[model samples]
Target chain A: MDFNIFLETSISIAIAACISCMIKICTVTLNMKSKLDSDYFILKNKLILAKKENSILVNKVVLCNEINSKLLQSFFEVVKQLLSLQKFIFEKGQ
Target chain B: MKKKLLSFAFLFLTSFCFSQDHSKIIDSLKTVIFKKPSDSIKIKAYGDLCWYYRTESIDSAFKYGNLALKLSKETSNQVGEAQAYNDIGILHYNLADYKKALKYYDASLKIRSVLKDTMGIAALYSKIGLIHQNTFKLDSAIFYATKALKIYEEKNHTRYIAYIKSNIANIYRGLKQYQKALETHLEIADVNKSINDNLGLTRTYNNIANAYLFLKDTVQSEAYYLKSIDLALKYNYKKELAGLYNNYGGILHDMKKYLEAIDYNTKSLKLREELKDSYGITSTSLHLAGLYLDLGDFNKARNYLYEGLNLSKSFNINELKMDAYDKLASYYAFKRIPDSVLYYRQLFKSINDTIYNSRITKEIAEVQEKYNSAEREKEIQTQRAEIAEKELKLNRKNTQIIGLVTLALLLFLLGYLLYNQQKLRNKQLQKESELRQALVEIETHNKLQEQRLRISRDLHDNIGAQLTFIISSIENLQYGFKITNNKLKGKLTDISAFTKETINELRDTIWAMNKNEITLEDLQARISNFIDKANISASNSNFRFNMDEALSKELVFTSVRGMNIYRIIQEAVNNAIKYADASNIEIHIKKKYEAVVFTISDNGIGFDINEIEAGNGLSNMKKRANDMDATIIYKSQIRKGTKIILSV
Candidate 1:
């Protein structure tokens, strides 16, 4: 009877040890998975913000270019008008 | 002499009437048109009046030109129409509106081309070339000038030829080809002298001197310049004298004679001031600034540059303003004022970019305009040729129609033949489209039939054979049950058990097929249960199974992939059970980045890993892994149990 009890105790201990080892491994794997998910969310947020910033910068650059072109066109028009006026006055004097 | 008298009379009637009361002349011409209303007289009156008011009153010129165009069109008179368009173009040219000028010039050229008026066309070319030259289109200027020269030479119009040569020479001067410019000017001078054209002679000598100056031939340039100045004084040409002084100041400035440059520039400035010439004043101020800068008087230089900059800006002369900004930048840099230097540099760059971009825009527009005009000419030529062909064809058709009308009784017989020909053409087109659609439909039907046959073959060859074998085994088991021998009973029992197992496997296959839509959570739970059962059956080994809880519960696998994974795990466990005398086995299921991973390990007496060949079971495991696009690895040693890792 004592031997039977000893074998049962050994089996129970082995089962307990196996269960404990499995629980420990599962816990470690779960922890690693959660950490990877958290990292993925962080990188996704950074990429989204970067994309938004890049778009805004591109819009500003486009607006600046438009303003520059308009200003140049106005300057050219003014120059053409003045040159015409000068030529007209010079011809009248001649 | 009569032609000369008529030319003078026309010039007098136009110029003197404008000098008198312009409105009265317009009223008188309108009254005459209202009374007589003759198309030829109306066109002549409008043309004469347009030339009179072209410079001083552009609107009145446009009105008269339009009236002349209307009258000329009413009479279908090409000469009158060309004259009206040319007058309108001259008015626009005087207004410095080159775009409007080009439009009228094109219209005039079109009418003249229709009339085959070579002289009128050549005159229009010269006018257009002058406009292009004034707008700084040197290449176009050269092109039109050459065209006009060729036409004048052909007509033996020597005076007009001299004028074209002088225009060409001026273009060469503007382009900075000084040697070519001098040669042309010399030719003009010789021609003018031969004709005793005193005004032309004066202009030619001035142009030659300008060319020599550009070539840096100081002695000849100075001599010619003096002669030009003397002639202007003799002619009392105040405007010409001012220009001569300005050119002389520019030359003196280039020679580094600062005081002489200042003196000549002052004289030019005084004359320009008297004349109220803002452009000339601006030029003299710029020259004075350069002299001050050379004399090391920074304050005076700044004052003069500022003055020039204001005048140039107010006049809207960007080129002069750009020059002033360049000078200002240098002055500020020399003054050692960093901020002022930077500001002026920025101003310089802005003006420079504006000028360059504007010039490029203008050039591109001009090139496109030229291309369009050339295309239009080509189109007109094609149209003319087509019209000529059509006219010839129409004349032939008219004659044929007249002959057919004369023989009206023959017309009914040709109609049936024409109808039959058209019917044949329609049939040919219909047949072509019908054949095309039939070929496409046939190909699609053949492909569909091939797919159906492949599916039917797979069903009959695989599942049908397996069912037939099971049926035969079952019949044999039933027959053996009737035999009472102990050995036969054992054999029959083994056969019965084997058939039952095969039935169960077939049922499992059906269940797996039905569970195609199972979620990953359910699959994981089933796998865990399977591992638990395996652990219970496994002797002398403690089994452990682990999984990641953080894996998404909604994850799913396709039936084919799920079945592959299950088979691979089953094979691995069987190998462990057969070969590994392990005391412990661990099965791990976890998520690895984007993949699902399964690892099975046992601590046992391992075999020589490298020497072991893949047996049937191992190969089956590899095949199952391959079906799922999964990777499998087996690690073993002589004394260590094997480990199998699978990733999908």
Candidate 2:
């Protein structure tokens, strides 16, 4: 009879421990899941902002490339006019 | 005349032998009975005392038998209960209470039969046979005795077989089947010898002696009676001896040895009185009364007659009572008293007639009982059939109702299913529309992002080509002209260098933009490339990058985190070379628990953390660490090395 009680107590204690572990694991999983969910939203927002910044940088680079190309075109024209003037100076000097 | 008394108290002989051997067994049994706490032991002890006192004390015997029987029933010891019933039956048999004896024997037989105690059942059969024999039911006696003998024979129970045969012989002798009686007694004697049962032999010898004396074989009768008497005396079987003496007296009276017969009869009477056997005493009393009447001893005749008559009346020994009455009528007639003779004669006839009438009434009552029970059985069977028919009708109605309910349930279920299906379909259609709209939105976003990447790649290609073409044109102009103009060459070199720097910056931006995720290996390769360039600029300084093998090569980070860590490393390295003027700089990456640790150390003129000014390099590193959810700590002294530890 004493052995029976001990066996019953041991079995109940094991079951309680197992259930408590399950509860604890469920609680931990919920906590981690919520934390990860919030992190995902925050990261998602950051990704949108970075994508906008990337688009702005892309636009700026494209505009700068166009402006630089025009500037180069103007410099080439000035260089052509300078070369003609240099020829004129030589002809006058001669 | 044949001595019609059964005298078959073989069971009592065996029980009394044990009891007589230990005269104080009753007292000891009583003492032990009171001492023991267990009901079973007490029950057994009480049963023992009950049988022990069967011939010793009538009231004590019944008291113990009742105690044993009640305790056995209370304890539910069926074997003990059957034994107690048998013991009580024997007590009744000894008291000449045949009805009560048969009742107890029937009770014992029922229990023993249920228990399947073969020996006990057979013993009850034999005992019941004795009761039937004593009651002049010779056919029933023969039937029961044969049943007992068959069982004993099947079991190879020789001693019990002898006991049963002795009963059968007595039964046969009473029925006056003398030839059959003599044969059965001879078989009983042989069975007794084979089993070596002395008490059985004593009873068998007496039976044989009676059979011989009745057959007119006085020589054989006298010889067999002496044989029985010899064994009875030798074994100290006082019960068997009393019976033997009674039979021996009857034989001697048949031989006209009246004086010798009286002596044996008186001895038998004294022994029966000592044994407290009411039947035996009454039988001997009547026999002695006849012997005295024969001897013309009227005083003794009258005394013995009254003694036997009173005892037979009290014990309900009707046959013996009638014998007493008949002998009393003879006595009165011999005394020349016609009034007394007539009175006793009437008494004798009435008792005889009552015995006959009671037998007839009992048989009629039994037949009536059997017929009434048969009618009751038939009536019960009819009622059961009616109940079954009603149940069948009710079941049919119940089944129809159940079928209707099931049909209604099925119809309701079918309707509910259609309603639920319609609801589910509408909800599904709505969800599908929303999913399709979301897919279209996501596809549009993907297309825009892809366009942006394509445009960025095209811009980088254009700008990179332009910068390279301009650098090459300036180099060609300087070399082809062989220009010794130092100012113009210096200006051209500066323009080329600036354009090269822009190209490198563009490449770095594109590298960071294209990747969604970066690993430590990727960062390490980028950092090593920057360090190589720094080494070329500062050849006197030593640069080291160390990564522990313990750190997993698969360590990954989001693009933002990767860009932040790379920028932090670059800013730290540049600050060390330009400001700290470090001779040796080490970039070490290692694993710490679950986190990765990066240590950028410079063995240069270190500045104290508290005294150092808050610069863009240090603040940028702190901001990057905070962005990545990492902690940064700067350890430095004025003269010691400066270390920046970042844990992620």
Worst 10 residues of 1 chain B by lDDT: B409-418
Native contacts recovered by candidate 1, as a share?
0.00
lDDT, residue B503, model 2: 65
- Which tens-of-lDDT digit does each residue in B1-648 have in candidate 1? 644544454445555674466567766666555555446766888887786555336577789889888889889988998899899887767555678889989999999999889899999999999999988888889899899889999999988899889999899889888899999999988998899876677777888889999898987887877787788778755556777877877778788888887887888787776655666777788878878888888998899899999988887677778888888888887788888888988988998999899898877887899899999999999999999999987886675555545344333323343454445445544554454444444444444444443443354334435544644654665575575546545544444444444444444343445453446676677667666767776766777877789777788876556656766777777678767878888888889999988898888887776778878878888887886678998888777778888998
Off by over 4 Å in 2: A1-94, B1-20, B24-43, B66-82, B102-118, B137-155, B168-178, B212-222, B388-648
TM-score of 2: 0.50
**Candidate 2 lDDT by residue in tens digits, B391-415:** 9868866755665565556556555
Which of the numbered candidates is closest to the native, going by highest lDDT? 2
DockQ of structure 1? 0.00
Candidate 2 global lDDT:
0.79
Query: Per-residue error at B36 for model 2, in Å?
Result: 6.4
Tell me which residue pairs clash in candidate 1. none
Q: How close to the true structure is residue B228 of candidate 2, measured as C-alpha lDDT?
A: 92
Candidate 1 yields a Cα-based lDDT of 0.72
- Judging by TM-score against the true structure, name the best candidate: 2
